[model samples]
Target: METIVPDSEGRGLLARLPGRVRDLVQLARLDRPIGAWLLFWPGAWAIALAGRAIARWDLILWFGLGAVAMRGAGCVYNDIVDRDLDRRVARTAARPLASGRLSLKMAWGWLLTLSLVGLIVLLQLERTAQIMALASIAPVAAYPFMKRITWWPQAWLGIVFSWAALVGWPAVTGTVSAPALWLYAGSILWVIGYDTIYALQDIEDDALAGVKSSARALGDHARGGVAGFYLGATLLWGIALWQVRPEPLALAGLLPMAAHLLWQVAGLRREDPADALARFRSNRFAGLLMFLACFVVGTAT
Candidate 1:
């Protein structure tokens, strides 16, 4: 059996789970926690930057749970919608839905289960935040179709992924502020850059399947495209911080994250799938850098 995905996964504790449980885990992507971390960080940043993060540590924990549940739900829904496309994509061909290891009904069931968990997390927030969170359903449902109709589905993904900032701000302050808006926009640009790196792994297969992405849209210049997006992200994040504190320190707080983005762009290897996946996964740390910056600025007197 030729492995479409690199057998690079060590399986660790997932290897200890029963066969069916492991399949379900794979279906929800619990085996790969990067997506959940990517999803969690924007909301965490928003909480931290809202100036009450230390006092509102509960928001971070609740949002973290929501990120995991909702990220899993989104992946399941995407797999369900893209099962045919998945079958043609090398990396996704072995996916439970694509391989028929999981029935469509089962996949839908899992999606609903995960969604319910997300809802519980949502209800923990203020009414304003709850409404803001619910508003995201339309975009999330529309996401699976974007790759088919648009070359820049990552942009749509950016909108959906960065929405946590919107929800988080209202959860903390009961309304959106300029800083939160800027942060959300910056995070959107960040997603486009990182997910574009992720799209690199599927560029060849996506081309064969008629799936369009920023990776293919930029062609050989995909590396430069990612660099541009990361630069835009850093600039917008600076603006976000500056709005909170018109100080050199707030902008300087962004230097570490900016340098990390530079590293990703400088090291990008478009032709190497393993290298692309590594760069893509490294955003998990990129996220940490941004969160620490947010915390510093948010808590600074």
Candidate 2:
């Protein structure tokens, strides 16, 4: 069941740009920008949700920088860890590490550079937010190995990816509340649902590699599991809103987002990897819709 992703000749032609341009693309994962948005949106949403005034573009700008840098660092680390397995997988086999375009030393150097940029962004955050950001390092470091040892690396990914919620609340209000915790919980479930879809693209390769994932664990029922997770996410989000404003109307804003999740579940085609990737990337829109719901709920009520 080795899935061979045919090379997009168009992409290969585009890669023929100057070598420097190619290296930069590989370094920043420009070829895969979804990770950056996935990382940034929760933090941005949390900031908007906690704001006493309209969400400021300046805060979004800073979080954008942090997201790009941190996501680059995370990708570099993942490549380092998965280099061997990556070489065995068709979709990842042409990556910098797997293709031998980048040595370990060069990869480490790239990782450090990205991390320094992320550090600079961290310095701009409030003290509480800065500390919260620092607390994520260990979990981030450990995430690359979780798939080897557990059947639920998607859950670990949830924790790692949703950390911006913790930092965002502290950035806006200097401390987290019960409502904020609920938001964070909902964010984690949302990550799990989407990342599990993502993991499905690699399930056969992962199973052969002796790696475990929710996709492989859930097998043919993955759609049901994903739906359940999305439903739980919507429920937690509604509960968080209720905790903040305790009004039915306060939760109404989330219904559209809930419907969107339902659409994702109903539209998903489990056996199609391309369909899975599309559904997974579509979560960016889901994140935006939820962010708007939170912003309206927090700002108006």
Candidate 3:
């Protein structure tokens, strides 16, 4: 049997579990919660922006659970689809599917299990929210193939990952509105920016594997591209706040998030993979800052 190394991000936690159990946990990325955090924030932001953060705390809980489960399922599906490509990338070569620590059958079974958890959380949603959430299925299913056909696969990820904003706004307001649209739009750009940073880790291996990414496409201009994307996101989020409260102070809600994004861009070392991963992980805090802004602005009298 080949020795399997755990993903660096998850190694600490994974080291404490039994062999097979550890592999399963790693497969679901339970050991690394950053992806789930990113997936949950848009929904939380929408709920807060809909002025229901306190009234609909249950929805926040459900969305949080759903984010973890659904994100896990997405990772498993992506790993299964990109197993071959993963083997070609140094950063991803140790993933369960690519490393042969887990079989396709096991991966499929795990995906189904995680998806069932998502389904349970989906049942907690309103009919409109449920339908809106369901609508994301097609995009999510197609995401794994985007890198094969386009250099902007991150855009597709943005669409899929930011989908909770659509479901969340409807869940609270019972209808999708301009504010929700703006939040969703802004979130898409945010994802594109951060995922672009993430792709920096794989640029060389991706080139060798012929996998296209925004990071590779931007090349020497990646920092500028990230700056542009973050700027667009901040602007759209500002619009969302304005649409909701229409107060000058409402726009100030975005200042913290905007400043944080600026910090990420200003300090980003594009040539360093470790720096890229740290920057990518830092979006978890960025998400929290945005959520706090939404909560404060949405609840103001």
> Any residue pairs clashing in model 3, and if so which?
none
Question: 1 or 2, which is superior by lDDT?
Answer: 1
Candidate 2 Cα RMSD (Å): 2.1
Per-residue C-alpha lDDT of model 3 across residues 71-123, encoded as one tens digit per residue = 99999999999999988887778888888988899999999999999999999
Clashes of 2: 0
Could you estimate the TM-score for every candidate? Answer: 0.97, 0.94, 0.97
Please state every model's RMSD to the true fold in angstroms: 1.9, 2.1, 2.9
Best by lDDT: 3
Candidate 3, residue 253: CA error in Å?
A: 1.0
RMSD of 1: 1.9
Go through the candidates in order and give each one's C-alpha lDDT.
Answer: 0.90, 0.83, 0.92
Tens digits of per-residue lDDT for model 1 on 1-301?
Answer: 2223531133779878887787788888988989999989899998988887899998899999999999999999999999999989888888888888889998889999999999899889999999999999999999999999999999999999999999988899999889999999999999999999999888888999999999999999999999999999999999999998899978999999999899999989888887888888999999999999999988995
Q: Which of candidates 1 and 2 is the stronger one according to TM-score?
A: 1
Residue 296 of model 3: what lDDT?
Answer: 95
lDDT of 2: 0.83
